[model samples]
Target: MAWKVELTETARKQLTRLDKTQAQRITKYLRRVMMLEDPRDAGKALTGNLRTYWRYRVGDYRVICEIRDAELVIVAVEIGHRSEVYG
Candidate 1:
């Protein structure tokens, strides 16, 4: 089944800080890759305290998401550069 993806308010704000091209790239990745039968196939599971979230790499940026399997939803919690995203 195809999973649904939703961006949190914070994620949307973070995305707006990026350039138009980068923003489009992240959104495209979400629609094309994250909306598949299994979003996990497209992203790696975060380690440590973030183990509950999944991380998708898009160039220098990282999209952190929470996968709710029961609801078939992927909630985009945070979006930022890789270096600072995990902090």
Candidate 2:
């Protein structure tokens, strides 16, 4: 029962803006997310819309990701900075 995490295109571009250390940090966070049995267990909040956000803190940066059910799987829609995430 492992959670599946998928990165959106925007998130992929955002990675280029991060420093080497931060990039590695994001990779580590992905590993943790992969180990999750339930995506919601690691989810911090849900606005009751079509979105749920799972947060992972890496130093000063926050990795904000979205989860949605795809058949029997949970899909990670996007990942980005906290500053521009909620807005």
Clashing residue pair totals per candidate (backbone < 3 A): 0, 0
Which pairs clash (backbone N, Cα, C closer than 3 Å) in model 1?
Answer: none
In TM-score terms, candidate 2 sits at 0.68
lDDT of 1 by residue, 1-87 (tens): 777889999999999999999999999999986558888999999889999999999999999999999999999999999998888
Candidate 1 residue runs with Cα over 4 Å from true position: none
lDDT (C-alpha) at residue 12 in model 2: 72
- lDDT of candidates 1 onward, in order: 0.92, 0.63
Model 2 lDDT per residue over 4-83, tens place: 66667777777767787788887777777777766556556655563456566666666666665553244444455667
Best by lDDT: 1
| Model 2, position 53: C-alpha lDDT score | 61
